[model samples]
Target: EAGVVQSPRYKIIEKKQPVAFWCNPISGHNTLYWYLQNLGQGPELLIRYENEEAVDDSQLPKDRFSAERLKGVDSTLKIQPAELGDSAVYLCASSLGAGGETQYFGPGTRLLVL
Candidate 1:
């Protein structure tokens, strides 16, 4: 019955550094997602996982960003050589399934690249 959990709520690093974010979705939830939000934009889906399979990841920047869901439970997102333009809020969300279910979101990790 616990909600999603994320670590290192805030992170700051210089450009070209690597930064990672972690997320643990709610129990029993089968669908997990990673999103990115810029200063004034709505969250954009970066990747989506149905259990251990990545169902959607077209928006993810393969050059410097990568993600994985372990055993269909926890997930991690990484950005290597992060660019200054990458400063934004990274959100993690989960739901019971892909259809009709209400998704729950975590507090999110704020990354600042200087």
Candidate 2:
């Protein structure tokens, strides 16, 4: 079985610019994910949804970053007026169900803000 798919595997932009990333999860997976991984640190959950409702988004910066899984299959994460501090790898993952299940991850969209 294939893992999740994320587009534009790399991105570069100036500070305060807007950027968006797209993800397509594996077939039959009900949960999709978005996470942030800074240099030398483990990935941190940003937003997670099962079917179309976000179940965990406590770490997501609502002021600048947002995500949605409108159809429960594909998802998008957007950052408006992105900050230089936001330069990191945005990872996409999926699992059959929520909570403690093994997730399949994509290569991720690495962002570099100048």
Highest-scoring model, lDDT: 1
Put down candidate 2 lDDT per residue, 1-114, tens digits, no spaces.
777899889999999999999999999999888999999999999998988999999999999999988888899999998999999999999999976889999999999999
Against the true structure, candidate 2 has what lDDT?
A: 0.93
What count of clashes does model 1 give? 0
Worst 10 residues of 2 by lDDT: 95-104
* Candidate 2 wrong stretches, greater than 4 Å: none
State the lDDT at 78 in candidate 1.
98
CA shift of 85, model 2, Å: 0.2
lDDT of each candidate versus the true structure: 0.96, 0.93
What lDDT does candidate 2 reach at residue 109? 98
> 26-71 in candidate 1: lDDT tens per residue?
9999999999999989999999999999999999999999999979
- Leading candidate by TM-score: 1
